[model samples]
Target: MDIDVFATAHRLEWQRLDALIRRRRRLTGPEVDELVELYQRAATHLSTVRSSGQDPALTARLSGLVARGRSAVTGAHASAWGDVSGFFVRTFPAVLYRMRWWWIGSALLSLALGAGIAVWIMADPQVQAAIGPPEEIRAYVEHDFANYYVEHPGASFAAQVWTNNAWVSALALVLGVFGCLPTVYVLAQNAANLGVAGGLMFAHGKGDIFLGLIIPHGLLELTAVFVAAGVGIKLGWTLIAPGPRPRLQALAEEARAAMAVVLGLVVVLFVSGLIEGFVTGWVHITWLRIAIGVAAEALFLAYVFVLGRKAVHEGETGDIAHRPETAPVAG
Candidate 1:
């Protein structure tokens, strides 16, 4: 396995195969046969060069040649639409369903914290004063709270909400590997903010208005955030308890599923943003707005429970099993 000798011996065959691949469309029957032969031989060469720890440059060259040869042999893969279809039908929903308890628990816990904070703030004048000046609080409860939603144009507001929520969710996922503390901090901060706002509104006797405005969009929006935090926390937990699988394998599986959740939440959050921007401020009908929110939340839950369950039953783990780029060094 002399590195220089191997490279010199197979260099011509590699070049010939490259040329044939570039012009594969116009190759005669014999040339196509020769191309296939050369490709097979080069694949073996690649394996040998790699195993022997020979010249890295020669290995890279062979790797590229084999990849191109695979494309030529296998033709193109399935269309983009196929991938998208599989994602929604299997990957996204399966992930949501599989991790339902984690996210649901997260939502319940966060809601409790937020509600506790609100009650504490309402019960204690000192808490209210600690938050801000009385005049500012009065202004917020009387005017600012309701006006915040309507201050911007609906479309612009929706876009802003989408961007902000997506960033928060993405950040949670990205930082998940650091352990669960950061994820818990994110969840706590979100809950505390909600608590403060609700406490202020309730204390001022604008509780009904708060419910009318926040419930319409908050149901779905908060659920999406909870899913992100739950999945993130689960990622951190995977480090502590990888279960039966090896730690790296367990982490990889969770990571793949987390990615699917991230993509799925983008769509979920977008819908919630639309409700917040368009329906919450401008609709002005209490029952109707709340009904719309309930409907959206129900649909999302159904999607996860029904479709996701089915996909999981069919053995979809939300990870793409086949990856072409993962050749020998792939996966």
Candidate 2:
């Protein structure tokens, strides 16, 4: 097929379609009918160009023109509420379920590392000495640790925790494009901190206090972090080995998926922050607080497994509606 001849033959029709799409709002009933017919014709033209293996540039421009035409004819500007509803019901859960193993592994590894570090700290006298004098350690275990939460007003404290956790999750996600190194470092640091805190509390015979406070919020809070980190690592791996797809294409898809996880985790972290600020410190009953955390965690897991699995089976990829995304090139 002669590229010049093909483009010249269809150029007028394409230009007419473009003009009608631009002025679609003011089109009369008959003109609207014309627009729909032109849109369908342009779509067929695009399919022909794609199948012919003509210039990639020609295919891309026709693709865009057809997309715009379709939008204008079909009223593609959907309501915002509909988009939000679709995200939770399909996008969020599908992404969560699709990547479940990645996050679950992260959660197990981090928790194991944290618990191991705590045990090591407790058993090693030298490690205890290295941390601080016994008296300072005891003071932290009994007073300063718990006091940290109550020092600020609940509302302010919740905001502070939410912002901090959100930032951490964002970093893990954004930096993950480079490779998994940054995310791994972030997760390791977090796990180590948890271990140190728990180990110190147990060493001073305040394990009950530590568990009571941490369990109420830490369950959900830490899970969100692990999820973020896991997704980030997965994004980095996509760059390293994109499998059968082109590397850039693979990275773009994974990056989009990771972003959805990032947005969803913000709400999850906020809930955990609320529990930390209000329930962890304020609630007197230990078992009740832990139960609340457990319940929150349970709901999250259910959302992923139930909604996510169903969405995945229904072909959700946690991405926007599929269309040709190739950028237009000058003809």
Candidate 3:
């Protein structure tokens, strides 16, 4: 018998026997043990026949057994949405909670970049000269800043900011599958631009003014970007180090993890957009901006940390509750 034929036949017989046991709908411990023994014997016989390069009949029998086993295994009904709730509660929260460091690090990095650009623009005489007179800068700045709010007084500036955040986040998540290169490049460019803009504003003695305008919506917006970028990096690295699993299998697993991160980000983007569109546009008071910004930041932090922890706990409890229990055997 050919080795492949023998192996296939051996599997088929085991399957058929398994199906028979299930169909009988009643089995004692000894009966189950007997079935197991028969399966082992069949497998052993198939192996021996293959090694001897004989017994085509044995190979055929084994093939039939394998088919039966497959049928038995797949015969049971399964729930369609059994996995989704657990995924959201356990997997999503775990990913977000664990990634807090990435969010904080990215925010600090963005702030540093912004500060560096502010200093550079302030110190550079040539750049300052190129930027032209103070009147030109003031006129351009006033027009750019005032035009939108002036035209649409009822429009939510906070919401627009949040929308921009969602666009950046979606880009990060979708492009992350390609590896971290795209995400890293995008982050770098954003950081550089922020820095340049900050520097220009500070050089013109508008440092406090700029912060007042940006800080209202920036805290959550910036954190979301970093979290999204971190997720992309993680996905890219999974492809690079698949460990014992096949490359494709590893990639699939990483994609699952990335999806959880992205889902949480959608929530973040929605809230951030609301703040940007509504709060930032209508609220010109510094104290009000600070109050609202702090409250928003606190809410996000609580969601990521406290709510995520609770989700993990709930997942563990659910798993224990849902697991099938086996009956005790008679002596």
What are the TM-scores, per candidate, against the unseen true structure?
0.81, 0.93, 0.64
lDDT of each prediction vs. the true structure? 0.88, 0.88, 0.65
lDDT of 1 at 112: 95
Residues 91-207, model 3: lDDT tens digits: 666677765665566567666876776687789967766767767777645555434443554455545555677788777656666766787777777787777666777776777
The alpha-carbon deviation from the true structure for residue 283 of candidate 3, after best TM-score superposition, in angstroms, is 1.0
lDDT per residue, candidate 1, 258-294, as tens digits? 9899888989999999999999999988999999999
Question: Candidate 2 on 130-210: residue-level lDDT in tens?
Answer: 999888987898799999889999999999999999998898777777888998889989999999999888977889998
In model 1, what are the clashing residue pairs, if there are any?
326-330
Q: For model 1, what is the alpha-carbon lDDT of residue 192?
A: 96
Ranking by TM-score: 2, 1, 3
Model 3 reaches what TM-score against the true structure? 0.64
Predicted candidate 2, C-alpha RMSD: 2.2
Query: Over 4 Å off in model 1, which ranges?
Result: 1-76, 324-331
